[model samples]
Target chain A: MDTYYKPEHLSHFASIAEGNKALAEKFFSYYGAVFADGALSVREKALIALAVAHTVQCPYCIDAYSQECLKNGSDLEQMTEALHVAVAIRGGASLVHGVQMLEHVKKSSM
Target chain B: MGDVPLLPTWGPDVAGPGLPAASPRAVRSLRSRGSELASAETQIETVSRVDLSAMPYAGSFERALRENGWARLEPAPIEIFQINLGKLCNMSCRHCHVDAGPDRSDEVMDPATVEACLAAIDRCGAHTVDLTGGAPELNPSFRTLVDALVSRGKHVIDRCNLTILLTASHRDLPEWFAKRGVELVCSLPHNRRRNTDIQRGDGTFEKSITALRLLNAAGYGKGDPGRRLTLVTNPAGAFLPANQAAMEREWKESLEREHGVTFDRLLALNNMPISRYLEWLEETGNLKRYMELLVTSFNAGTIAGLMCRNTISVSWDGRIFDCDFNQMLELPAVASDGSGFHVWDFDPAVLAARPVVVGRHCFGCTAGAGSSCGGAIES
Candidate 1:
């Protein structure tokens, strides 16, 4: 079976720079700065990245951030809770759309 | 104490209840398993297999030192004389770089060797004596060695596996150590139970907590310099440890809030890739990446503080090494003539002038914040 996602690609992420080096460099530089310790700890940033990875359903991000989270000292319980935050948001996103449908039905009926 | 779980005498088969799915294999030394990695040569070969074509210093530890203007690592007057009593441990933690376990009982230091070590200590001028092993307390002469060191006016440290203090015979060790003013550097992989147990064995966390409570009752972890209780945490898995200061804060808050356990400080260490840990890295297919991580994360700032520069590690039988990791890999500290030196022949001046040994495993020490037996080298 042909697979779209390859585990090895995660390690080869730098290859994305091949097509446009300057832009990729800027993005990477910014990305590195973004994840660094600030008001939010590196561990906290990693946890946020983990939750976002799950929301975006990016396997590369998931793999990268899972290791990153662990490396930054986030435990399994914390990581699992971060994933649930993504799940809740993603679920709420779909459910909130029900309001639009409800408004449409009330206008169309009586 | 009655509610606390008792340590198993041997393997993972007798691990406590509610063991995580990832419980480690039966307690046995790599030597007994006849693993190729049991040989230090094979371990060195494995660590050297990583492709460092793109890495600075070409992933060569010695070359990295040279390139960074450290032509050699020479001892700064010995401050710590670390003794590896033996490998006779009750629990065979998966990430143990020593390959220590109950099966290693035969490897304990004999009385003659202990006497030789004391003689060396007298001449070495080290203010601190660090006793380490599968469990240093398990040694029959542990108290004898401690009393000897104390009488000589040396500060003694016990690199304790917290669970060992909960064992039946060793149960009173907390108070015993407190009485002697011995610093207890206990290993408790995490503040939480799950990660701690996963790396160690089942019920290890509970046993550790129970032991900590005992230590507390004995007046440890109470901000008393005389009763200092230091906790050492290595990453439970392949990753480098978090910032020591940061992790110490978090560990303090969490442990105190949740378990009502207090500790003086935390020492975050990087797990060296050797022995049983090296085996786990290979089996999990993380050997290559973990090695690369160590190489690329190398911080030159950590060179001066490298434990090998100031500490002399004496093996159970009196052989000497730059540090404990080197001792496990059988890399003896050599003399000017390139012959392996022994504790009995220890000459502080000669040892000080000798260049420290380097290998691929040295990268583990220099990685990230840099790790040592004491903790991260850099702030």
Candidate 2:
């Protein structure tokens, strides 16, 4: 009976569309932790958002995280550095599979 | 590209006391050229259904847009137009907000309607001409519109669905766009094929990559200055776009290292509630939570920058609106009535004097980072 969504038409968000009370509570908990200090400042969260954004791989998430990073006083340099970490991990994850190929090649050559 | 008729000729009402009527679209041009947009407030209030929302999400959307005016920008430099030529798209992404698919034909705008739209563009003097559709390329006249507009020195933006490129008939689309200097605004939902496929359908992400590659080969997104290219990001469900600037860098780095793809900028857009998204909310029963996200993230600062403030949305059928969002909902384009030129009559002086009709939906733009055609309006 509650009508929150308007009809102008763009993709809706997960949290908005799911509306689970449990999730809301969890969000309240994590949202606090997300901003709270634990080796990550508000500025750092912005950078992490930029990095994790790619890892989780949501375009909307990336957009939000990028802005959050900027607002927390992180400059472009810090943001890019964070994204580099993601790129390195993502790239390394794919390349590391070469171990299987290497073992197969060794067996064949033998 | 010049000399080609981008739109029919329409003169400003101020040019002379009594110039001929332009077209219905000319009435919609009020979003741009602020001086001419709000000269007549009372007339607009009388003719159109002031509010168009089927839902009662926000209390004061119209009031906010009227006060802030996204479509009211100088010459209206709208970052994204997201023009829906009609509801007829080739691909049927489940999360499509416009509910565009091969089946939805009732809303499609014909070619004559497009010409009327061209006239409105001239009156508004908007900088970017964003062409969208079921697949904008699916429309026979899509090419002509781009060719005509680009020639007239307008920035033509096309929200391309990648699959269109893979089709045999659309094979030369990349070249056609390149020849016209059209900015290829594309979407992939997620770089990972599985994620994209789950939401968009099987093989979508792969074909998207192929389309992107074609664009890259055609000099789009390849770290080149001569060609302009951009990508759009919207959440699968209700959420604000991931931070645009950093996201842009991430997209550039990952796609390049993996697929040798690169583009100029990445635009993050928040999803609004309309069409297919509405159906999704109803079918899955998640409407309440989605609204909370929008309300919680409502950025008052961003509201002033909502795209409708300065951008005028012209429907495929010649109706005008403060933004494309408003057009989909059937909100009548506000008209300025100084010279007695009504909705269909293009009188610049009269058109310039109209006040915008605001509604509850305007809150979508006011939310965090403030949504606009390009991205965040304030940040």
Candidate 3:
């Protein structure tokens, strides 16, 4: 029922940043309760953390969880593989829009 | 290029980072508006490697909000972890926001730090692990990290650089990932080689195609069955990306028909201006133009679905950030006692609610088809 995200260090940060008050309180209130040594592995948490990072784009969370991914004993190669999913998604997002250009290009070329 | 208007709905004029030589009357008008308060500091500096003036006045928020209409909005956190291992990458693209390259070594994530990461994972009991790097494959402990997570039964994601797969050490990577069932996400920039290679590098397009073939042989990118492979795309300049569904169809058909390559999906991204991109804007005298475009395209839809609401970024050194772009700027993560903004020290609730610091560069994510770690701003 406990997690590292609920550490006292979090309180120190919340008090420092006016913006984090509500987020900190809400996240902490329910964060630790989610994992009460249920039918889950720490590796799953790393993956979930990673996905959430993309969902939010938190650099600090990415930095912290990347190492957590490894320490949980996730293999080196797999770590790269997992992270690529995020980069590929991020990078592909830009290219997917070339469609607007494609129609314009064809019409102009004609 | 389309039967276009003389003035694009999203175009602006500029000489450099800003408008050139404001007229006396214009300057007086600007001063009258009190926006001069923000630009007064911009005058003292030409372009410093680091500028504190741009740092938003955090102190004024408590005062300014009561005086105006600014109020912080908060969101809940989703349970998937996608960490940006570092900004260090093998390539320094013309528009790379993090300015990652072979020369960048400051944010490298080490093995010991990863051990701590593992502890957090176990402590959190998450079910998915997404690892990314400059070329995440370049991480010395990349394989170990993957194996560890797989051993724990978490789904693994790889932000692959297709060129890396061509390297001798990574030659067996396709098969290696196959064995581990790692989902492969590669950057293709475009379906056409010319566009991709030009933006990534001279040989990148060809190498990416080759890598796709290798992945296909490993059952990746094949729409038919087996493991998954995906490709990414983004506009080449400061502009909005095309529609996602239309582009994905074309990419699938072209890659499959031409190269016999297959992939599960295509992701479209919006390029934010930060490191190299900011430099690009300054050089091409498009900074103001780009900013205007971003403001013009600011979608309330994008603001509501911003990646920061659900995801949090971590630096290679185990620090925290609202997003990867913010990480490169070296901004503090929540300003903890003026110490370091490391993500490790923050409480999830407080950190999640914290109002994110925005900069001129944030325009990239807020522009048309807003971009973030999730590819496109779908909502």
Which prediction has the highest lDDT against the true structure?
Answer: 1
Q: How accurate is candidate 2 locally (lDDT)?
A: 0.62
Off by over 4 Å in 2: A1-110, B1-59, B62-83, B336-344
lDDT of 1 by residue, A1-110 (tens): 48998998887989999999999999999999998778888888999999999888999999889988887677788999999999999999999999999999999996
DockQ score of each predicted structure, in the order shown: 0.53, 0.05, 0.01
Residue B3 lDDT, candidate 2, scale 0-100? 91
Of models 1 and 3, which has the larger TM-score? 1
Task: Write one digit per residue (lDDT tens) for candidate 3, span B242-333.
Answer: 55665676567767898888889887887665555555566667665565556556554666677765655666888776767666666645
User: lDDT tens digits, residues B162-260, model 1?
Assistant: 888877998888888899899999999988887888789888889999999999999999899999999999988888987888878878888899989
Deviation of model 2 at B307, angstroms: 1.4
For candidate 2, what TM-score does chain B get against the true chain B?
Answer: 0.75
For model 2, residues B1-379, the per-residue Cα lDDT tens digits are 7897785455444343454232211111112224221223322232122233333334345443444444542223433334568767777775664556676566677787777666756765667777876677877778788877887798888888878899998999887878878777787765445446655777787788888888888988876654677777666554555456655666677778987767788776666665545545444555555655565565657654556656666666656666776665666555543222222446544444565555545556666776666766764
Ranking the candidates on DockQ from highest down gives 1, 2, 3
The runs of at least 3 residues in candidate 1 whose Cα sits more than 4 Å from the true structure, single-residue gaps closed, are A1-34, A99-110, B1-27
Select the stronger candidate by DockQ from 2 and 3: 2
True contacts kept of 1: 0.60
